[model samples]
Target: MRGLLPQLVMRVLAAGLLTVVVAAGWVLWDTARAARRDAQTTAALVSDAIAARPSFEGLAFGGVAPTPVFRDWQQFPAWSLIAPGICVELGPRDQPIQRRCGPYLAAATPPDWFVWLANRLGLVPEPVAVPVRTRYVSDAYVTAIADPGVIVTRAWARTGDLMRVAVGMAIGGAVLTGLLMIRLLAPFGLLLRGIEHLQRGDFTGRLPRLRVAEFDRLSSAVNDTAAALQEAQAARAELTRRLFSVQENERRALARELHDEFGQCLTATRAMAAAIAQSGESTAQDGARIAEISGQMMDSLRAELARLRPPDLDDLGLRPALERMVANWRARMPSVRFELGLAGPIDAVPDDLALSLYRIAQECVTNAIRHGTPTHIALHIEVGDAITLTAADDGSPRHGGTIDSGYGLLGIRERVDALGGSFVLAPVENGMRAVARLPL
Candidate 1:
């Protein structure tokens, strides 16, 4: 579950630390090797200086008390150059007549482990001895010992500086690596936030541009998707409002038909029946009158039912239903020329789609006749890759063509939109045109 930023920082820290360790280790090894060589050379030089003294051999001859010839240890030329980390002594016995030591620690004091490691690795050179003899008999021995602990101490001191640098570099590298990763991955954060907005049904959210090519492309795609979704949401909201409005209108119209048409027709029929009964003889004329009244009531009922759903739409299919509607409209508006053009596979049209097309067409025709009062109304339906219905009229479109002018056209627009189609009502040169296109 580790994130990318953390992992990157760790790797960078490790790399920085490793580099420091390897470099520091090499330096330490090189220092150790040079220290060993320096110790040996110092020892040899010190011993040779001691041997070159004029009375050096005689001073330790016969192992007797100190003679007048023995000079103080500091008086000898050999005393001055007992280089650091070296020791010089006289005589072969366990106790030397004279002795001098170089610095016990020429560098910083080191830990016991450092010294042990130095000795183990042969970084501390071996002791050197030079015997000063008068003739065949040995007078004394001059010894130079590389017994001082300076090499390890010096190496350890240098290692301390390296460790500090290593620590600083590691920390700095980790911090810089983390910051860089966060900056580079900032786009991903924005993407997630955009997705959150989508989850909350807020398609309006947008993302900023990114410098990286891959991230920029991803951001662009997200922006495009969000724009599309926002548009779709707006459309859906509009469609829902239209649906409610249409439903309410249908309800009000149904109520009116029930109260004004059905109610009065029933009252008149009952009055006529009472009149016929009072006469005690239902004559042919009286029966004919009742039959006529019944026929009128039936027509009213059929009209009310058709307003909700046209019966022909289900039983006969889109083409035939539309044709019948045109015939009926022609009968109603005899003076107006009405044309219904049908093409493509109309019968195989899905029921829901057929209903939508039929309803929109019906609204267009009804609106034109009732409001526009056009002299000639042209309606066409064609189905190909998509279904298109265009209704135009030579009549005046000033009243009914404006979408905002009436609920009828609004309902038509809604139906087309619900079918994922386009609807437009605009005035052409001669008259107004309404076009609706729905995908198959």
Candidate 2:
């Protein structure tokens, strides 16, 4: 698509051209009208002058006479050389018309094309016939005609200077406007390039200060945005590294626990079975001890599985899983009061949205308890046009500002980002609040 500069320039040129056309047309029209009037007046006066002649009065009573032509009107140029083309025709009513015109004076002839247009448009006046009258029966007729060439020639003479000025002014305005537009839009290219860099994920791109105040502010904003994005990218990179480390450590712990606790428990059960088989009987005390080992193993497996993907989530869906999680946390932190609020159709959320919301809430709660040591923590989940999950705690204030990025907070952000949701972890009311919203 064409930009504003070219469009504005074209409009400006078009307006100037239109103005010139209108002004030139008005000037030509006025001159042509005046020229036609002068031709008509000259014809009338010549007819009057011819009727009073003694030669015509001495003619026969039947008014049968030769044509008398007068051509002196050409000697005196009337309004804009109009009289030059005037002609006087006088003759008996039944005879051929007489042509009596003067030497048609012309300083310059108008172009054939202009004369053709004037004639085609019928702007040139037709020859007018005026009857000669006397005391006796009058048979003389004087006709006046103005040449189309004369009318066009006169019109051009009157309008040429103004048209030239209009053309010059138009050219000057276009040039000045183009130059000014070019200067005004110079910064647009730089801004476009900087924005392209951002689109390409090259946050390192920066724009320079511009002379125009509005463009300068935009340049500064671009520079600031690039800096902010660069910083966020670096933080995310660090977060990835730390998160990977945390995952590896957790996996190692799980492996160690499996080897130490599970191996021992299975080994002891094997030994007990061997002894019981040898003894050919099952003792109550031995059965109780075996049951205790089985309980410990089950507990250990549940804990490891919870660290990965909670079994409750897959089996019971989102709401129940969240309820179980809260129950577990409440059992673990009996002194810390917890509130869980669920609204709207929580079950209608899709798998990805549910997972992300659950993770965000889980992370926020863990962070509040682990870092902030809050006495009261609240978690609320709402599902409508969008799925919203908010977790807040009455803990020590990190201040009512953006949360400092940590491994847990990053994990929460990652999940929400994957689900195309916005996440904010900020301080509120002497506590921390983490909110996430995902579109349904």
Candidate 3:
């Protein structure tokens, strides 16, 4: 949109310039034509006046001397002024006549190119020849040459001045058009920048009101969109935070119930079994079997409680909890290698952030083992201004697969988004990589 303005402006300017040039050419041509017609009429009137002069009629009839008439013709005031370029003389019909040429009709002749152009346009008038009517002669005639250079030169000067004015107007129109375009598009620039901010997740940016009606409508629409996005994002963050809180609370409650009620029941059953086996009627073999079964039940219950919620997370902090979890996975899957890289002060991290990171890492490792059939898994956690967790497995990529809500990746995404963080899960060259970043 920004790039199109200059092109539009240039086209308008070119059109305006073309219009002015055409108008100037037309005006010059018309004025030159009119001047040519007027100069021809003026020359005709001068010729009629010369033919009516008695001195000229007497010279043509041979009743008067040519010397006196020629002298008088040159000195005549009206003829000298009106038809200075006209010449009058007497000669035999068989002889060539030579007359003294008068001054040019125009005070100053125009340039050669201008005169040529005027001639091409048919502005130059033909000479007017009028016969002097007399009783004695029929062949003698007075010739009047109408020179239109004076009129054409003056018209050309006027046309030149008008052309200059037209050019100035064209330039001024272009300048005004440019300024108007800049003013109209000013609001568009602001709107574009605001949209860029929104794309970067900075929804707080707003577009200012514009004077143009269409631009104002666009500005209002953009502002509304930004506000809606900001509101929706805030609501989603709050909802995610509440949901995670409730889920953690539920896990803790379930773990407590398993430990307090179920664990106590298992212990009481084991004691009763041992007491019965100790009776005189019970064999030593039966007592050993009963004791072994009760011990296995208690061990299974403890493992179930740990799976629900790890007590080490609260007591030993995040690092030790993760190390224990990884050790357990290594024990379960002896064939697969597990690597952990922890950096920064993990102990100083807030409980909620540490839990979110831990849960995400645990889910990634579980997915790698269950689905990816990975030979090696790498888990890395770095804490600073932000906490970054990355997990990768060197196994077959999980191609064309989706994770259900029960798979735990959904929960990790919610937790990360709640903290205004980013989560990415993509296939690597050898397997899959999961990355989560949470702000400190």
Best by TM-score: 3
lDDT of 2 by residue, 1-440 (tens): 99888888888888898899899878877866765676677667766665555344324556576433334433433453326656555565457355655345574766777667667656667777667665443676666676666667767666677778998898789879989999889999999999999987688878999999999999999999999988887787567545645664576577567757876776677577556646646575676567566667767766765755665766788889899889999999999999999999877777645655776787788888878778999999888888888898989778533345644766676666545567888778879888888878
Cα distance off (Å), candidate 1, residue 386:
31
Q: Backbone clash tally for model 3? A: 0
| 2 against 3, candidate with superior lDDT | 3
lDDT assessment of candidate 2: 0.72
TM-scores for all candidates: the values are 0.44, 0.48, 0.64
Against the reference, the lDDT scores of all candidates come to 0.73, 0.72, 0.74
**Can you write out model 1's per-residue Cα lDDT over 1-440, one digit (the tens) per residue?**
99878888999999989988897778778876665565566556654554444444545677554333334445645335666666677667466677776654446687788777767766665666666543323566666666545666777778878888888989897998799889988888888898888886677778998999998898889889889998987889577656755775675578667767776777677577656756757474675577577767767777766666566776677887888889988888799898888888888888767777787888888877666658899999999999989999976646345455435877776666566678878777777888889999
Candidate 3, residue 317: Cα displacement in angstroms equals 2.9
| lDDT ranking from best candidate downward | 3, 1, 2
TM-score of 3: 0.64
Judge candidate 1 at residue 138 and give its lDDT. 56
lDDT of 3 by residue, 1-440 (tens): 45757876788789888987788678777775554454455445544544455454455676655322322444445444344334333333344263434454344456788778777876655644545455444565555444465556765676677777987887788889888888878887888898899888888888887888998998899899999999999999998888888888999999998889888887887887787687856475687678789899888887777767877898899999999999999998999999999999998999987877778888888877777678899999998988899999988776634566745677667778899999888888889888898899
Total clashing pairs in model 2: 6
Clashes of each: 1, 6, 0
What does candidate 1 score on TM? 0.44
Please give the distance, in angstroms, between residue 179's alpha carbon in candidate 2 and its true position after superposition: 3.6
